[model samples]
Target: MAVAPPTTSQNPLQLELQALKAQHPQYHVVIWATYGGSASLLPGARWIRRDTLSISTNRRNSWNFTYGTHLYDYYVIIEGKFEYHNKRMKAADYSSFVASTAGFDFGTKQSVMRPKPEFRADSWMKHLSDDLLRHGPLVLDKQLDDVLDDVKDFLEDNDREVVMVMLSFSSASAVYEAGKPWSEGYRIKYDEVPDHFNREFKKDMKKDKDLYTGKKWPRLGEVRGKVVICRGWDVDAEQDQWGLHCRLPKWEAAHGFTSNIKPSALAAHRWNELVGDFGKQDAPKSIVLAACLHHDPADEESWIPPLQTAPILQRKAEEHIRKSTKKTKHLWIYGDEMKKKTNMAIAKLNFLGSDDVDFTRPPPMTVKSAPVLLVATH
Candidate 1:
């Protein structure tokens, strides 16, 4: 299921790498690239050996990159369905990193209340420091800012503005933000994130919603001079802190999308209108995005193209294209799910898989996308 990395570099694998090189002529130059996800079909999809593609969460291999080290000019930390392997290192080096495992008995001692409990009224959410909890978009402000600082030191690029694109905004696991962008991981987390917080987030949905709203990207070609911070979901689908580069398609709460507004879906629906009215419309200066993946719904509360979600995705894409201006705005999506989704929303998803890709490991094999964001215990 790991695609075997191609022992001898076969036909498709070679071709794929070559094509990526053509599109992204800057390979070794990519200083901070966090790898993960299945975007083999995307036209411009290219990944730098960008920091070891930290697979410790996917497996138990030795540490790959340096702790507290800065090698590139940019630092992009991806937080998704991954758990880093840092137990062996001194706390100082890996002190702020994270690695998480999914599916549990709830009553277990160690994990029973490790994170979710700390955030839920029935158990957690009260004691944990919002400094690192990532329960919503605002919660990420600090942590994201810190990471940005690190990137700044590395690239000699100091830009304050932060941009984020969530795939599972309204997703429950997405409560960490608000499931704005849809993902494939939250579907399996049917119960991890709490449901109560969702209502609270929905109140702010009319603003800049998360992954679950079923909207697309907003129009941002207007600002031709601002320094932008692009944010998208981690595509690895691994549960870790540095995995924030791409969006994962999973279910909710702390472990998935952290928002309540799925604005991406809306963008997807209005794609046509947006493109047509581009120069005539008033949009944001820049935009960051999280193009995550989610479950293939089969029932009501989540079924048939997952209702409004599809429309949102389309709109977001248009918004992304609109914001490509070189000024304060740029476009970034964590996972390449769109490359595949662009062709077919449904395809051979769960054929050959592993905990490397499937963190929750459900029956159908695919992870859930985004769910309504709810408080862990509220």
Candidate 2:
């Protein structure tokens, strides 16, 4: 079990923005990914959940962000979960195909000799590429479509210009790159990227014939009101390539923290350790951090206290920049505590709106005080 200490700090959101304004003094766009707590706290940014803008709020939305196209036109895609078959085929069929090609499936089902009319085995790359395309971005295309559409809707709603010109990287991008292909028995794709499959997918999508001719998939600069999807690896050949940032979180992953430590205390400590990495030349101009203040009440493993998340993330961000001797400027965004509280309260009320509702009182909610620091860093 982990414990956390307290720290006093002013409003993290305000402090972060003031620092950005003072440091950049020019237009900047941030592409970030974090949990809801941090998303809601972005100062001038708008918080649009993946569903609120793309589909019905009833569906789970993964991506959330504030529109900053006025400053930057690029879409720095970040961030996860659950599982579905990418081949969209039944297990038996995939097993049969694999057995016919690999001599056995899971080393159990042997490939029997075919009947009189036999055939040559398909190229190994053929089978491999098929599986990769099906399991990779192809399966994710629809969900990503929803995200892109939501961004389009925001642009339309606000009448902002759309363009994706550049790509940048942070340590988070490295985490994503670290995701190797999911292969079980032979360990075929461990820590390896199937470049051939990715290139082939891109080539097929770019074609002007058949199913590719008319699709919602945003092609590079092909349509109006659509933004290009840029990968961090594509930004610069030498430095911006995919890899982990120097600062690794003490926790398992940055997605959610579940220890008994108070949210603020945990965030402050993590920031203290990670702030130095902000000075890296390839550090993101804008960071999308999972708001520490917003924890899933339903997530029993997560031990976040009310309001501590936002302040903790904010404090850590400020400290990251101030302590760094490198002359660099950036902004960090996380969730808003008050907004989360309002939303959480409303959700509770909605749960009881039904006549069949047996529950009366809402779930437990609590708040704790954290030490604040009044000194300014210039």
Candidate 3:
């Protein structure tokens, strides 16, 4: 008798799902963020209404839910990008949080004025491994499996382009230590988990890519309605690393935008880059952005507000449209509450249904409804 391959308690599907959920619980935030922005104004693009974005109550608990309920023809998940801190934090406190989360005992170490290898803490990877072992894999494989299967179906389909921007939680710390050697050492320590998760997630995604081998599809090639795929993360070919690179944009520098909130700027940069890259190349008819929700949990003094993040996304989308041809963008939200909150936030931006411009598409009417009907009543 042939023996089946041995399987572990946590399969690849479960592992990937755990990593994604832990990093980006609100995974479809990108779609919600970009929907009302300028990208929706592109001609020939379909208009998405607020009511249509609600997710079934049953699916709300699912981490691997399909974005927009499979309404689009093509779906693509962009890799490399992960959620970063949208607010400021003290370096020492930030370091402590990461170390504790990873199970490192930073308290035992004495404060040193200068950094040396002797002062370096243990490899954070060990703590992370232990943490995973302690928590065990979350029971989310089934939902995630369904989501990935949906993407696989899109990849096989030759009709249109569908993309999903996936954001990774690259680290427990939102800000990395810079300049000071002590902080630099801590940054390196904190990055261990993010680096490992990125490698593993990409490995799983590549398996999906392999399924497309031997199939040939025609490129859309500047037909004005070609489908596009937009990824939010930066992929470094030389280093084989996938994540955001620490850099300052000229505009932000001129405006004195601080480092903690660079993720917003990066998000905008990736949006414009997609427009330029896709406009120049032939691809699918639809674009999917795979990005993290980037909403942080409640904290001591204050919480990361979705309202603040909403404008950043709006600005990013607006900037992209100003530089490239406009296209219809889609929005999807998981629940009624989120949909309402997101709509309100987007509305306040004055980018949608504003005095200067209107983003709401005219309601579709059938032939009979369009005809001038004369009242026959006496």
* Candidate of highest lDDT: 2
Query: Against the true structure, what is each candidate's TM-score?
Result: 0.25, 0.33, 0.29
TM-score for predicted model 3 compared with the true structure: 0.29
> Model 1, 1-378: lDDT tens per residue?
001111234544345445543543322111111121111211112133333423243355634442111111111122221112333333322221112112221111011112332223322222233323232221222343353333233223212111232323222222221343334333222343344544444344334221123223322221111212222332232332221232322322222332343545433433443333223223221122222222221221221122234325434544444364522121112212123232121111111111122334223111122111110000
lDDT by residue for model 3 (264-297), tens: 5544543553444324323222222212122111
1 or 2, which is superior by lDDT? 2
lDDT of each: 0.25, 0.29, 0.27
RMSD of each: 19.8, 20.0, 16.7
Clashes of each: 140, 22, 20
